[model samples]
Target: MRKVLDPFSLGMWAMILLVITITATLGVWFNTERRNSNPDRRQSFWQTKNPQRRRKSAYVRLALDSFLQKGNFFCGASVEHDPNANLASKILAFGFGFFILITVSAYVANLAAFLTRSEFQSVTTVNEAIRKGYTLCAHPVVENELRSQLPNAKFFFHENGKEFIGMLKDYDDKKCEALVIGWEDTSTDIDFLSMLCERSLVFTDSVLAEISMGFPIRPSLSAGFSYWMYYGQKFEDINIPNLKEKYSPTEALDSQCVIQLSELSLQSADEYAMITVQNMYFPLVFFAVCALIGIILQCIYAFSSNRRSLIGRVSQLDLTTTGTTARKDRFLMRRRSRMKSRDGTQDDGRFRDSRIEATEE
Candidate 1:
């Protein structure tokens, strides 16, 4: 059987990367959720000093330390008020500072790498070397280099103003062939290197250069980038119809799925498209839901406050017969002048009389 037919060969690196990423994501997600779901001040994880004894694993210990540190940052307890809380906070602060230091160090290392000549190597084929009348496409830079080296051979630029790199994995069941041009010189598995050497064709009189762009290889950082390099001017690798599927484009590319550079273009394209569409409407949806919730809460508050005010006002109001009689006496006194005016001979008196007769009915 062909070695490439093995499942282990197909997605080994992808699986390993996926595992690490998943762990980091879950750690962040569950950690945040645990904090939000259980805000009880009494239930602190740092209090258990022997947590490692119960739960074995350096990673777990690291997680516990991380959680303790984050907790301390949020809860600024004084040393005198709560010694334990203060200690936990200090431990967390130390860990946090350490993590930041490491991250900065990695970024610095990555930057420093760009200054030096990359160990990356490339195999070139002269336009004359390739079989005559065979279609050949290359990057503008690649094409220029070939043109300079081989003045006798004819060259045609790819259409669409875009160089055809390689077909990404196709939607068909069969995998596509790859046409590699150049690759980086990072530490790779010797076996994998040997496999590459054996399976890949190397051209005679190909120029080798020590060029530095960033990392050892493009694939180390981005699978999509690597995929392009691997299959430049090659056919696509389609999805197998009846293959036992662990992942799919539709489900894996959903908004719930996190974005990572390591995903293949077929997967990434779907994910990117989904995110682009959702982002367009996500803000509007969030605001609408928030407004609805706010309106409901405001109505509840208003109803409660109004009910309380009504009860309080009713208690203060007088309802005795004595109070009613006093009010009636005040009304009678106010009407005495009007009654006298109606009896007198005047246009106003007549008008008042008509109003009184209307009221009497």
Candidate 2:
């Protein structure tokens, strides 16, 4: 694990070390070369007049003289002190923005497709479609030729139907572009076919444009030479050589040049499904789980509050009954004690009165 992550973690440090080493080596070489080339002591006269101009002019003269001496050196000189200030800053800003846009746009597009369960779709040329891994639907003859050229791509076949019919209705529904028959169809009325072609923007001139049109054509148009036959010239221009076959020096040069050029023109689309699976789906699932937990907690709180309210009502009822019974007992005890004490006091007074009467008599 440590070894695996070391590359990503220490990439910046490695780059910085490389830059420092290159700068130090170049500086030492440049100083040594400058000292070796200019060993005269005429600097005393120049320093007396203007030291700043003397230093600047000496560096400029050295650079220009060095470039002149080296035949392979393709150097351009500028007198400005801050030659690339504005251009350098603008280029840096543009690069930063471009990288940010690429990363963010890739994220957003993938996220949208993932959440919706749909692939991001776009129309592309026949060559472009093949590059992006989309199979073309065509006749057996066309498929055979195409397959012979592109073994990696899978091709679909439609029997009896016209070329456009095969591509539009029979091919993969989710894919954006399909190879269809165009104005090159022979049996259809030329005027009507032209109208259809115009409405569909089915241009037979370009390989990609033909793939973009969603329609089929009759066999005469497929076999006969018209716009479709003329379009074969573009295929010749592609110049894809057979992998198994050997070629002459000229053929080899031509093949290599075409291959290099084709690679330059080609651009691979980002795979939205992979991005969605990696970035968006997990986050969405986690957020949904958190939401469900919150709802369960709310239900628990509501039930708990109701239970607490019922317990409070019961406690209040019991307290009220206890207070009323205690008051009633106190009242009854007081009444009985008061009656007993009063009767005792009356009896004592009566006995005293009788004794006093007897004594007086």
Candidate 3:
């Protein structure tokens, strides 16, 4: 037992138990009090009278009442019938109100930001583009691979090197929706297109497939060539970033290039200006689930606590009534005994008088 109740272990277990007990007790007590309190006396949580209202004249009150009523929907805290309950309760209420205000303000700001931003809806992946029936332009070498992967897709083929530059111009001119090229081909096209067009074209970050070059040579020379090529490739990889920077266009492009390139020529700017609510589905669902759970737990706690409190109050009332009834019965019994004694005394006195009269006779 001593080993089991070591200082560290005991302290941890004690803290856990204490927290659980305190939370459960508070929850039960709060739920019970809320249930016992009259609903008619409770104001809506959002309805709050301004502090200045107390000092205002009647005329001012009448004038502002309508405005206040309308504005109360945005208020975060409401005063009860007795707002002067306690310092701690008031402080807690204020803190809660402030928290709600900050949260609501932040949400409104975020919503406004989302609304004002240019709405972008594009295929983030190759499969998504294919599924949406988007046409793709690719180099001739990988046309077969693309056709195999995207069998139903409409594809335009371009030769390697400078010839592939036209595909980028075509895509920008709204001839094709996307350019599906290998990672190497994409790098090359970006370099070439960057020189030809003032606007730099950005490709999908997804790499469809990798292509490798093979050489046919005598076995004797193949080993030496393969070894040299391996080192040469590593050297080229190191300088690839420098090469890209050297070939990159002198003119800068705005961030809207991708959206501008993808949009159809016939489509209006208003179509792209439309709002797209992004990244809200999961969080909204999560918050709704949490709120529902809280309501359910609150209801269960209130019902249980209210029933318990009612039973307790009834038992107390019964005890008090029983005690009062017992005292009343005792008092009545004492009164009756005293009256009997007085009547007995009177009868004795009458009998004595009669005896005295007989003796005199």
Largest TM-score belongs to which candidate?
A: 3
lDDT of 2 at 116: 45
Whole-model lDDT per candidate? 0.39, 0.42, 0.49
Q: Give the winner by lDDT: 1 or 3.
A: 3
Q: Which digits, one per residue and each the tens of the lDDT, describe model 2 over residues 249-286?
A: 22423232321112323321232223322333343344
Candidate 3 per-residue lDDT, tens place, 228-343, comes to: 76776687653555677677533343333332233332243433222222323333344335434544656676687679978877577888998887677666655655786777
When summed lDDT is taken over every stretch of 10 residues in candidate 2, the lowest stretch is: 71-80
Put down candidate 1 lDDT per residue, 1-361, tens digits, no spaces: 3322221223432432332343333333233212222444423442344556534464466555545544443233211122323222333333333433433343344334334422214323444334343333333456656666655554444434533322111101123222323432211223323333444332233442334464366656688766675575355543233221323333423343322213333453442221122322433344335434544544565577679878887432555765666666556644765676688845466655765654443
Which pairs in model 2 have colliding backbones?
A: 125-208, 164-215, 164-216, 165-216
lDDT score at residue 165, model 2, on the 0-100 scale: 49
The positional error of residue 103 in candidate 2, measured at the CA in angstroms, is 37
Which residue runs does candidate 1 get wrong by more than 4 Å?
A: 1-89, 108-123, 126-361
Q: How would you order the candidates by lDDT, starting with the best? A: 3, 2, 1
What is the alpha-carbon lDDT of model 1 when measured against the actual structure? 0.39
Backbone clash tally (model 2): 4
* TM-score, per-candidate, Cα-based: 0.18, 0.21, 0.41
Relative to the unseen true structure, what is the Cα RMSD of model 1? 26.4
